[model samples]
Target: MHVKSQRVFTRLTQLKELILESDLFIAEYNLDNIQFVQHAEDLLIPDGKSLSDLIGEKKFRKIHKIIEKSFKVDLRQFEYYLPLLIVNIIGEAILTKDYHLPLDIFLWNFAKESEKELDGVETYASQQQIMQAIKMKDQLKMVKDISKRPYIYRKNILKMAKWYEEESINLLYKNGKKSLGKYKHILLKKRNFIMADRFEELTLNQKSFMAVGAGHLAGQHGILKLLKDKGWKLKAI
Candidate 1:
């Protein structure tokens, strides 16, 4: 890593440490942890630039811009905020000489983590379209009753909820570290499709965060475990 990158990696690690340390009080995250983390101003810069500059200013800013909208945080016009976050994260990784993690690893892991949070995503075209057409004029209960036809099942209802959950997770985490194994056998290929969709924005070797749902982060087939199996270190902070 370059001199600037080293600093950013170190800070990233420290940020991780802070989150892990504080998660104990949050009930596996009782509230939005981002609000509690250091503000952008906290990651001071010289001449006003955080470490994200070392990577690429546009990329750094773009990531933050995406986050600002998704996270709904009101970041100020202060230019240093995003770079500081990147620098701090990079600093954490520099603790060990071998701590240089692959950019693809991070991006891929982020996408995976994201899917874990999205429990299920619906294939409405496959079911809802036909079901709705059959009962276009029916009342809510009547529509639901018609859904019981072979076109839809208790299984379909389960899938709808899963879709909502998984998408929610993806929107939040963007880290892609969560797992999608829970729905593996139940939803099978549908689950696979969502995981792949989460990182369509990514390419091989590009490093980026993938905000996903927290519920997807645990379990044996989760993103963390999957990444470890594929040979990437899921370091603490």
Candidate 2:
């Protein structure tokens, strides 16, 4: 076998060993962890930004002009908050005219109705810590690049949504890893391991439902594979 495949086999073997040795039971999972709502509101609902907070007034004006010319958005309205604006763009594209509640919140509400416990893998503080670690320069560059290909923003969203509904794990894994380069470790791997550990501890012998982002269920380091390694039987429903 090639080195990469060999390594994957080794990792899977190791996970099998861990699962065999552990005492936690593996509960069933959904076809895919759907996240119809992008949580863009959480990012944009905070206080407004100022020109100084974004690089500087001069550079901000330049970038804002470029964005306005290309996307026709009033950046000054958001105080040149590129990340939140980009998020809003994607959210708008995906959401379109739909008015349904986000699947995660819907599931949470259902769990509440059933009197089941609700938990998150990490707290809001930890999530913010991860978000704050990304450099501002990278964030700006990302926004600029996406701005140039604005149409692809929605195209990719639709493609992922289709792939997700189809439960195409391999395609989802490939695409999920493509966009998240340096941020992958903090956003995906570390959180997946932490959540897997938490799930093991919390589930024990009880059955539970975990509604995480669809991306979290893909890739070798994803939560599903990680849990599978720990001897959890995951069947699509």
Taken over the whole model, the C-alpha lDDT of each candidate is 0.34, 0.58
The most accurate candidate by TM-score is 2
lDDT string for model 1 (78-193, tens) is 33543323322323222323334422233223334444221112232332232323222222223223223423333332343343334343432222222112323323233333
* Candidate 1: RMSD to truth: 20.8
Model 1: residue 56 alpha-carbon error in angstroms? 60
For model 1, the local distance difference test gives: 0.34
Tens digits of per-residue lDDT, candidate 2, 136-187, equal 6676666656566756765776676666556686686677688778788887
The reply for model 2, stretches above 4 Å from the true place, is: 1-77, 80-85
- Candidate 1: deviation at residue 212, Å? 1.1
The estimated TM-scores of all candidates read: 0.23, 0.69
